[model samples]
Every structure is written in structure tokens, then in C-alpha cells.
Target: MAETREKLLEIKNLKKHFRIDRKHTLRAVDGISFDIYRGETFGLVGESGCGKSTAGRTILRLYDASDGEVKFHGENVHARKSKKELKSFTRSMQMIFQDPYASLNPRMTVKDIIAEGIDIHGLAKNKKERTERVNSLLKTVGLNTEHGNRYPHEFSGGQRQRIGIARALAVDPDFIVADEPISALDVSIQAQVVNLLKRLQKDHGLTYLFIAHDLSMVKHISDRVGVMYLGNMAEIATSKELYENPMHPYTQALLSAIPLADPEVERTRERIIVEGDVPSPISPPSGCRFRTRCPFATDICAKVVPEFQEYKKEHWVACHLYDERYADQMKQ
Candidate 1:
């Protein structure tokens, strides 16, 4: 047990590669690492196919990693833990899926859905106790006790998501991986769900790993934000630091794309549209993964892999350009 790895959940050199056709490997979550502190929301931002979901699932052991480790409360998550142990682990960590409609079972009623965790874990002693717990959870999520008798299809998209949230809360999890929880709902509903999550976190002291592309929403909710590109962490820093001074080119490009509410700011800000599609994760560029589209890429970038390291206290980046030349440019 190494010390200094504080903070609640720590992912060390986490890698998850899927073997496709037994020949080509899809490097879904390739060598990503980060630490999440207690009661803080760590937002993971990336475009589609960047393996944000894979990293979240791998952390939860929903998909066991191909390599590396996920640590929770200084315990190695990958170590051979029994079913009993895993069940115990489930009480501390949980996930809220992206699509509420698809994630929920069509056959199960809301009561069965939210109470499933409690029933499986034997948290309630009797049917009356279970019903009470279920009703309480329903009320917590802004759903009525009567709705508990109804099936998933009987509810709207937002209602289904609320049920999903209630199910996650059933276990009284300390840390939650909200895997794009608001993406499927109407734009109006998204804010309510996000607010619900925030309120839950504030009231319960819950930590979150929120994965989404709504950079604005992510920035709004997260204590810190990490940008991922092609299965690698491009940059990570506190929300304020990262937004004010995004070190990685990919992060800068992504931030640049964020439309400002003020017309004057929007007009003044220059958008960096990198030319070329994202390279295949199956056969990524040899050295710097972003070299294929990175504006600052050079000959050295094609030959040597850039190490992901911390140049500042909390900020981490994986680009070689964080060297002398780039540092001087900031002064200008």
C-alpha cells in the first residue's frame, strides 16, 4: 500500500483495449490515469468515440481492464475480490447510464427498479420497510409513490432518468459515475436532471465522475475537468485553470469551439478548427497521438511518444510542446 495516493478514487495507468477480429485492437481507454478527491465532480469531456464511457466503465469494473489498476479507498479494484466483496464494493460506487429509456428494463415497475439494489443487498428487512425505502427514494428524485407501480414505458424520458437516479441512490453510493446521464432527455429536462444530481451531491457529500460533451454543462457542474482525445488525456486541471489556460492543443481547440453567449466575445474569440478527422484508435500515430492533426506537430513528435506528466501542481498534459518554446509564447 503506497502512501501519497490520497483522494477517494485513483486510477493508475488504466488501459482498456478490445481485441477486434483477434488481429486489430481497438484502444478504447489507453493508458489514462487520474485521481478523484472526495465529494468533487471530475468531468470527462471529449467528442464521440474518444472512449470517455469506456474509461468510466473500466473504473467501475463494468468492463474489466486489459491492463493497469483502479483504486478505491486505497484498495486495488483489480485484485481478486470475491462476489461477497464486490457486492460490498457496490455499496460505495455506482453508475447512472446515458440513455434512461434503454438502460431501464421495460418490464420492471418503478418500485422494483429502484428497490432492486435494496432487495439484492438485503438492505430492507420486510416488504413494508422496502416500500417505505422505495417511496422515500421516489420522493427524493421528485417522482410520486404512485408512479412506483408503473413500468418504465409508462413514464416520459425525464421520469425514466429520475427512476434511474433513484436506483443509484438506493445503494447509498459515495462515488457515482454518471455516464452522460442527461444526453437522452429534452434540453429543458437536462437542466432539471443536472440540478437534481447537484442537489443530491451537495446534500449527501457524493463524489461524481460526470462524462459528457456539453462542455458548458461540464464546466458548470465540475470542480475539475479533464479533456480526452483519442483515448488519451490531453489535459487536466481545475475548471478555472483549465478554462482560463488550456495547455493542450486539443483542449484549446475544443474550448475555442464553445460559443460565447455575448456576441462581442464570440466575435473576438478565434475558433481553432483542426483539419482532418480523428485518427483510428486501432492504429493511432506512433509518437504523439495528436500529431496527425496537431498544428504544432514536428518531426520529433512522429518518433518519440510524449510522456503524460505534471508540469504544474494540478495541471497535467501529454504534449512535448510544453517545453521551453511554448513557455516563452505565454509571456508574449
Candidate 2:
């Protein structure tokens, strides 16, 4: 089913490095490759500082790429040099930022915030048309038309996020990068936002690159999931496949930490405790970045980097444990 769909975004060997000084260069996103299909939510999961956010930013061309290519609908995103070309791309791709409070302008009214894209894109001709469009968007995101006149400070975190979503939708974009859109909201409100995103995707024929640390929510909303560790992609698989049978040790450890609702299952389940903190990206471990914390790491892990390859039908992993050449030493 996935092979039949159109590829909306293709990221090949993508990397984003930040130079700290003359001596140090931080490898935030290091050569991660993945393709997001049209009309599907591709969830990217990792621990804090694993480069998920940096990868999203680089893909959207918010940050210049240090290496590799990001193609959106066959056109290279990073190749767009002129303001006119970038402005044209902005209409097709949009972003829903993590912090609703920081993302929206404090001085602008909710109506103005939502219609900013519309005005910039010239979607509306007259003032009355702009007002009607803003009011309609407000209603679509579960906010009333009357609320459009109010300031952003008057609304809650969830409402502000809805406004952000409405703003992204105002451009009528085909793809959106939702950078931890619900991480700041209340536990109860998180589900509401997730559901809203799902509904909007269906209504608008939208594709999403949903970035988050929450595995459960990712599984709930995403069709496929990619797990990252220390700036590299550890695994990529269908959400159900990845959660049920995680191949990479980092992915296994992350899924093990998610609390199950069933008491009996929770009590019997074995938790994978990954020891040691994540190494600094400026000077990561030689060969495999996860070797320092991986339980199954052998001498070969320090000497050789495992290639990211398909392990089992559509499930990809980058781990020496699954590499046939190191089978003898990696056997549990």
C-alpha cells in the first residue's frame, strides 16, 4: 500500500551541523534518510537533543543544510535561493511550532494571526473576504467566530495551538511539519489536539512530519515511525511493527519506558534500562554512536558502523546485532 502512494518528501543523507567554535562542530542531524508518503503522518521519535527538531527544521529549509538533499515534491528544498522561490514553497509547506505562546505574536489579534498567511499569499481580495475566511478557519479548528476578535493571551495553551494550526491551514499547504505540537498542552488536551490534527489531515488531504518524544501518541497518530539516537536514525518501521517488535536497542529501550495501561501486563513486562547519558554530538562515539549505552554492543561496534538496511519486510534498522557479519559475537 505504501509503495503505491506518491512520495511527498524525500530526505537523503541529510545533515545539520552547528559550529560551536573553531575547535568544535555539533552534528545535530547526521545523515538520516527517510521518505514521507503523501497523506500520511510520519512520526519522528527520540530522546531530548536527539536531533529530531533540528532534522525537521532543516527539512523545512528554516535552517540551511550542511550536507545532503531534501526534496519536496521532486524539487530540492535547500536549492531554493531566491525569496520568490522560497515564498512559493512556503505555500506548499508550512510548520506548526512547538511553543504556541512563542510562535504566535502577542500583539496580534487571533483574526490577524490566522489571516496573516492569507494576506501574504493574497488569498483574499477585500477586507470583508479576509474577515469571513478568518471566521471560517476559527470555526474549523473548534474555536468560535466571536473568539477571533480576542487576543492570544486570553486563550489557553490548547486554544493557542489551534490558532497556530489555523494559521498553517490558512496557506492551504499540502505538507506540514508539526514540531511537538502537543508537548506543552495538558495531558487531557493533548489527545484533543492530536484528534484535531488527524481530522484536519483527512479534511485537507495533508501530509505531516510529526516530531515528538511521546511514543504512545506517535503510535496513535502516525502510520509509520522513525526512531533516532544520537543524531542518527536507529530504526524505521510501521508504528505497529516498531512498537511490537523493535529491532534497535535504543528503540527497544524507548518503547519499554512507555507505561502500559493494563496492570497485569505492566507488572510482568521487562523494562530495558539504558545506562549512561547520551554522548555529546561534538565528539560522539567512534563507529556506532549508541555503543556506549547499548547492552549488546561488542568490540565490532566500536570498530565498524552498521549500515542502515532493511531487516524484515519494510522494517529497517541500524544495529550490529542484526548484521550477519557480526552474528557470532552479537548473539544473546
Note the Cα lDDT for every prediction shown.
Answer: 0.90, 0.94
Estimate, for each residue in 1-332, the C-alpha lDDT of model 2 and write its tens digit: 74588999999999999999999999999999999999999999999999999999999989999999999999999994698888889899999999999999999999999999998989999999999999989989999999998999999999999999999999899999999999999999998999999999999999999999999999999999999988999999999999889999999899888898899999899999999899999999998999999888888889998899998998999998888888987775
TM-scores, each model vs. reference? 0.94, 0.98
- In candidate 2, which residue ranges exceed 4 Å CA deviation? none
Clash list (residue pairs), candidate 1: none
Clashes counted in candidate 2 amount to 0
Per-residue error (Å), model 2, residue 221: 0.4
Residue 108 error, candidate 1, Å: 0.8
lDDT of candidate 1 vs native?
0.90
TM-score of 2: 0.98
Error of 2 at 136 (Å): 1.0
Question: Candidate 2, overall lDDT?
Answer: 0.94
